[model samples]
Target: MGRKLALLIATYAYEDEGLRQLTAPGHDAVALAEVLRDPDIAGFEVTILVNEPLHRVGAVLGEFFHDCRHDDLTLLYFTGHGLKDDEGRLHLATADTRRTNLAFTSLSAEQIDRAMSGCMSRQQVLILDCCYSGAFPAGWLAKGDADVHTLERFQGRGRTVLTASDATQYSFEGDHVSGSAARSVFTRHLVHGLREGTADLDDDGNITLDELYVYVHDKVVDEMPQQRPKRQDNVEGRIVIARNVNWAPPVHLGEEPTARASAPEQMPLLQVTPLSVPTPVPLVAGRMRWVFRTGGCVRSVPAVVDGVVYVGSDDGALYAIDATTGEERWRRMLNAEGVVRSTPIVNGAVVFTTADRSLYAVDARTGALRWERLLGSQTTLTVGIVGSLVYVGASNGVYAYNAEDGQERWRNVGQGMTSYQWMVLTERLVIVGNTGSHVYGLPQADSGKTWATRIPHRSVSGPSALSDDMSLLYVGNSRGELRCVGTSDGERLGEHGVTGKAIYSAPTYVSGSTESPGTIYVGNDDGHLYALEDFSYERKWRFVTGAPVRTSPAVDDATVYFGSDDGIVYGVDVTTGLERWRFSSGGPVRSSPTVMHGLVYVGSDDKGLYALQATY
Candidate 1:
């Protein structure tokens, strides 16, 4: 491993009256330097310069990069005023920087780039937490009046740059005074992620450059939505930046204190079964109840139990919030690399899959790690829990594990099978649709393949929905076709074709008599949510949206709720297909809505978990 090195420069007090003094840079530099110098964490030989003049700062920057070996990992951080010349070139302002004489008094990006270009070290990182920090043009060539392109300024082999904001926004400092409020929003999150060991996104004990940037970006945006962090990367492979000082192997029951590395499967499996909880009263009308924000996009569908909402996010953590007040109860970071994108399955324990191909079972009440199991290289396709068994679908196969200890009981691999939706779990079988134009049903008692039904001219777009009596399965495919099959042997029952381009949304069936079969609601890429008669297979009503409705709808007593890519959540009457209420979120709404305790809980790409009023 190469030695780690860091150069931190913070300029706050300016000589020119035109440039206002900033209170956060000096504090930010000192705090970051301390964390970087820790031998157990970053282990970098850090040199910090506060309020330094242009000549001294420039000389040290050159020496810092030029003196490092090709194998060494070097990090450069700047927190101050990033001013642009009349020609739109970015310049880092120093203590003696003059507004009128910026080119001569301030450090130019060309000077820093030249030093970096001359360095032999291939592993280099630059972090800028300043205003207009992204205004550096490509190759130091001026793009007269063009938008700021920070990547263009530092795009090279083995180079990475992280900026606090894009060219159009200003970096934010919470307050102008020298106190706790003076912390720079961007730098504060960066330090917190590293120091607290949360930046180790994969939960693998090592913090990579990509993980750190994502963790920092999510936190910065969550705190300051107006500021969007940007990054430029040209590295060949993984670049480990630091070790997570606070990380430790998960401790399980029956494992001795010294046996921290024991495999999860080695522990005895317990019968941790889900409770038989009654459903809450459904809402008659909808209103905005409360909105809770997370560190990153909340694309994972939320699971509500016992007046609490459990959700996951790209920020790499599972969050539990109060259903009524929307206050955070607890959070557990799973894996930063693959983040919690799959919907969480909450029983006695909360089961979730990360993009990193790992499945974790945690305590539902307290968010404590119960057990973890590593899956195949392919990302987890879907996760489901029933009684003492947990079912997982991946690109490689379908697996069954003990819900309590994550012990694999059996696995059935099928060639070319891939799923992008949820797994439909029945009392006797686990049904799943695949993009390979096939559907598979596995016995719940074991991994025996029950049936394999194939579709023609289209692939299964999402998960299949079973009828209330569990006799029939309704599936939607990429060809805008809705196919019905018998759950017993996967026999084709009936089929209906829609004019929509593709059906990515899972089919949702409302309960009715066996003969009636209620209404089946599904969304497609054509921006319409189609309602069809279950037995007749005839279209009843269709509601249109501003964008594609890619998520499955959650039907309550009288209303159906779903989200759209247009950043809106809509509640339409179940029978009339007339809009009841709509809530606009900050970004796209991909997470499906869950109605519980008279509130509809949903996650948005804007990093918010919203609790909309549905009661009165």
Candidate 2:
């Protein structure tokens, strides 16, 4: 049997003073429209209401109530301004709404409840994205001691209600590019979680309503400690709103044949056998460890190989440290004034590129400079080692140098304005993006560029993983937009904008299956660390800090680590998005964190390098 579903999206941008003046027209309405059209929920029949004429909320509600009755599953969504009257009744404001005649222009909770009273199906879901919606109130429960006595008569019903904030709280407004103003804090996380598929923690094809609620509840509280989302649920039975409908049922045929009716005969006595005892196996614990730190700010990532840790710092030096101890073995100073923002790439006995604008190859064991070359005047460099060749990006172009001699092999300069921060090398081609909003695919064998395609926006950070199949290239932009561009011709596959202030950090990929897919972690200027799944682009979880997060995230196993501008380093649960622990620092952290052995290495603007014991 086919399932029936109804979705209603309503937004009130007209009532918001800031929203009314924004140049971006239909931003909130368009966001809701996009969700409605998402392929994941194609089975749903969606109805949208936005800034309707005043004195017409009743007519709109009447139309929705009538349509919802025919659906086997119903979902009603609202996004707008809500308030409470002197009587404590919750009311949704309309476009031409006035405080004096709110009853005529706005719809109250009581009116909605009465309208939905006649719904036939047991499954009904209501999502209220408005201020003071928590005050809408559920059915009255007996007070105090009387509640215990009345519990026996209660029967579970399939009804769930989720509101944006508590009765006394107010919603916040972010930038217009973010899509909405006066949006409920809880709603932001809820929509993000749903879109990103973070609620599917087990990697199940279906996402349950309970999972969605739990993720949103925790993230909202973490981001806004004062405002709490209210949830009321009596729906115990799981309903499949959508699924892979193409599945075929197994076929079988049965006939009413003669029954064999003869076994009232003999019963055998029970026998007991003595069981042999099994030997217990002893468990062994792992013991090897390593630690390394740069004397100044260790703003660069560390590369571990051959029992040594290699890292760079703002002190303009690269250090090789013992893999098992926190002691440094040797240090080589690079002749540069700028900090090292690139990780050291190791090939054989040579360690390379520990400075921002120069490429240096040093002996892996002795820390002696083998060869040094100035790559460019301004380069957002990150090193990629492919076989014996090394790939690097600069403001001018992408360069390939022989790792054996530090000699230039070939350079691909698409344009003078292209500022490439990162590049990934494939067997046949090299993929890189620049601040000019262009991504180029260059052939490794030829000096000329293979293809160049413009990205949706300017990319300021490094490019993340290129799909194993080399089908898509994922990159994050300064505006918090994450996009997957085709590796073939740079055609846009899909894009999802992060719902934070701004994204200054690069994205990291988790290694896993496509179904249980890897995660993309990035920090935002809004002081939050977000984990988004790669397959569905659904948000897994988020951790909030007191300030912006300008550092990239580091992931090892099931834990995620990142530093924030609030001068704190956090370890979070990868699946549940819960904070396991946090370590305080002296100043703002702009450097990306590196996790190796059992320690987390990071640097702060306070001129100190920190090492914290990794606690699972």
Candidate 3:
């Protein structure tokens, strides 16, 4: 019988004071152990090493590799501190580590590579959840970020390496005392993609390294704009493992499978075809229409142009459907191993960045790939079209590309940058945010620094509505606090908290009474939809939903349409907070609803997409 194996090295908590500060407590080890112990993975041997005293990792690692058989699959994961020596060599810090005695306490990337070089099994994965791991000298680091030692010594064959950050960065720990030092932002999203099934883009049972990298890259950038992960691949050919396994789809409100329809009873049941009616005249009362459902989690805001709505899904596809009919006009498969978290930017004949870690110019009408340019190994945060340039943010940095050919124009790495999440484009500047709660303003001309401000809460999502005049910028944080910041000097206008729920979605703006000017609408994990009066920071009203509301809200005229985890899409009075109508779906409706042409478009976790009409 074939065996499966996982070896986890969590080297933070030990006698060595320096290493202890960097390693997470035992809980990190346990969490990883739990995943390795899953019934799905029971067939393989698992090994775990915590902070053992004195150069213990090498011997244990050697033993594990030596014992592995040809038919076994292996996963090697390490959670601790990583450093680069003076010579630019990557080293994994051991429990008894002392920076002064690198040779005695640290393990070099070359040593690990050499240890695994003789392994007969073709399916192996190496995950390093430590800072400075990108220094591993594999050809994975981009030109400027690569260290000379890594380029010369550590390259290996038939292996995939996933690192926490670039060579010069630090990996963080979550705030919780008992949790992993910092759920390597990359690992957290990788696990999410695996558990949610987005990593299996082709719907195959097993996930590929390519898919895993894309999933981790997109999710981490979406969740932690500050920390950009690095991926190194040096396989002679495509490495496929667990080829016959199927990944479960990520948990969404409407993802549940429905039973097949039953045949009509023998008593001559009449076939009822719903009558078609003439298209209703556009409501003169400034009412909005909610219509189509994507039946997947909606990550990006819907793009509406020329009566057609475009959006991306966790299902690895970009969908363009009729704004009124909810009928799919075309869906370009991203072929990514993860969900499309960023919204699609549509420009005439081209629609861009639904997924795949690249900026793709696709045929807007036919869903064909017109052109694709690999920007970096991170997810595209928020993309905007300004004249001839397409502005986008990825984990590695911010970039501007030619709107027509997707050519590189300019990129500005975030200053004091830990990670890059979302960016808002203003007339004179482009403002982007990081996980460290810092926001940077880059002048549009030379990408020169304008001004940088730090918000109170960490920004997990993108910035929204910097105002057409670029006066007030509205931003939300993971702590569920929404604030209006002055674009000029980054002065705090005011802030309001939506309970304690994290605001995972971007805030949307609606024109308030000419008196109020800017009213911000956003959703929270606390399952509430909120409307905040811009300047005064007063809570206009809040509507409670059945489940957590992580998707942003879409507003048109007087009504607001959004989806909730409760498996329902709601249409509510924007001013009164009254439910105008509610449509139940088969599963959760975590995706935001797009309102256009008398219809709302959203995707549920359920397998079927839906189109609903409001009956008065």
Candidate 4:
């Protein structure tokens, strides 16, 4: 593994009276360095220098570059005043520097650039967070302005530079003297972005140079309007700035004392059995009971149970909101990671959620973390709970754990493939679907596979849905086809293909789902909600929308409620395929809703969680 190293320097207290002293930059260097040094976050061996003089900064630079190895990724960050001399030479000011004698008192751009260019480390990232920082890269930007094409100039190279603003603009910083939260406006967002992992555009667990710059640029422009962050990169391949904290390495349960002993000694492979799904409460629709706004995007469904609604956000917090008032009851943050897309499962007194690399079990009432089992790599997949066992599918393989105390029971490194890990479990079998185009049927008592069925033509789309009794499984593929398979032998019993577009959402089953028997609701990329009869695979009704329907539907007695990419939450009649009520959430509603006690709880990309009941 290549080594990651960083040097962070912030000179906040300057000697010049005109250069107003800054409070956020010094704090930023300390806070950011602390996170980088953590084994979980960036994991960089970091060195921080606050209010250091020019001589000290120069000495440290000499040691940092001279000791860097060829297989290392090195970062140099500065947060202080930046000025360009009359000859266009950028200079970083130190506390003892006099503005009149720039060459004698300050650190020159040539000094740092020469050192960086001569370093043995091929991947060098230089970040300037002070005023006029963007001037370093402004000379090469597209149209001599900041743009994507200009940003692309850094592609395919091993060297990159990032700046806070253009030469003509000043980087903004607020004086946060008293508040516990003190960070330079730019550094604050940068640290938060790197820590949260929400900046992973592809959700691949790694934040690339492009993704980080884009995230930071957008935030700085959005939050500080006057600032325009810029970047220049020469990275030959993807330069991973940080890994998502949620996808921690896997930990076996019996490896610790708090968990259970091990898997059962020896047992016969059990057959798949049916399980019952609870009925949804019928809501009248049209009136909002209450509305709650979170700090970030609410892209996951809200799971409502026992008067508490559980929802996860892009901010990486699992929130328990009051079902009656939409007020928060308790909240748990997922170890300073980014984005919680998995819908939480509330089993008994615990709320189970998969974020980054761990499957966290939190107290349902108090939002306290009970126990966390690491699932190797970055996994945003939802967990499956059957009886007292919790199953999670991760990048490494399939894992089973004891739910109560979080001990690993068994693990099967089946083909070692990645998964969204939306799984279905029965009393006897664990059914797993993956992007590798194979669905495996694992015996619940053992880690061996009973049968592996290949769904040729494409990968599995979203997660599979199971009938109440777990007798039949419904899975969709990237080819827009929906297949029904028998759980006992992993046999494909029937298949139906939609239009040309793929089905990104899972099939949801309602009562009477025997074969050709009960109804199944599924959303597809063709911007339609499909109502099909179970056994015969016949389309009963289809409601068309303006955009793709990647969010699963929540159905009650009379209505089908789901959101569309077109920014609408729709309530359509189940049988008639007619629009009953449509509410505009002001953003895309990809989060599936939970209907409980006549209240429909759902989340939107607009950062709002809404509860709707009948207007009458």
On TM-score, the leading prediction is 1
TM-score computed on alpha carbons, candidate 2: 0.52
Model 2, span 536-588: residue lDDT tens: 78888777665778787888776788887656667777887766655545456
TM-score of 3: 0.51
List per-prediction Cα lDDT, in the order shown: 0.77, 0.61, 0.65, 0.72
lDDT of 4: 0.72
Residues 1-616, candidate 1: write the lDDT tens digits: 5667789887766656566666677668777877777765676777776555677688788889989998888999998888776677778888667766777989988888888999999989999888663334335644455346666777778899999875634578884333445468888888988899899887877788899999999888888787889999888898877777766676579875563442222112112222111111111223567889899999878998888889998999999998878899999975568589787898888898888889899999999899998897565547998888899887777789999789998887763446523467888888766666777778888767889888765555556678888998888777788889899898989889976478876789887775565899998877788899987888888886657788889988988899987676778888878766665565678888888867888889889999987644
Residue range 119-159, candidate 4, lDDT tens digits: 88988888778765322333443233332222232233478
Order of the predicted models by lDDT, top scorer first: 1, 4, 3, 2
Model 1 C-alpha lDDT versus the unseen true structure:
0.77
Tens digit of per-residue lDDT, candidate 3, span 123-217: 66787777553323344343343432333344566567776666455665554334434355566665556544467666645556787787778
TM-score of each: 0.53, 0.52, 0.51, 0.53
lDDT measured at residue 611 in model 4 versus the true structure, 0 to 100 = 92
Off by over 4 Å in 4: 1-285, 416-421, 513-516, 614-616
Q: After superposition, how far is residue 497 of candidate 4 from its true place, in Å?
A: 1.4
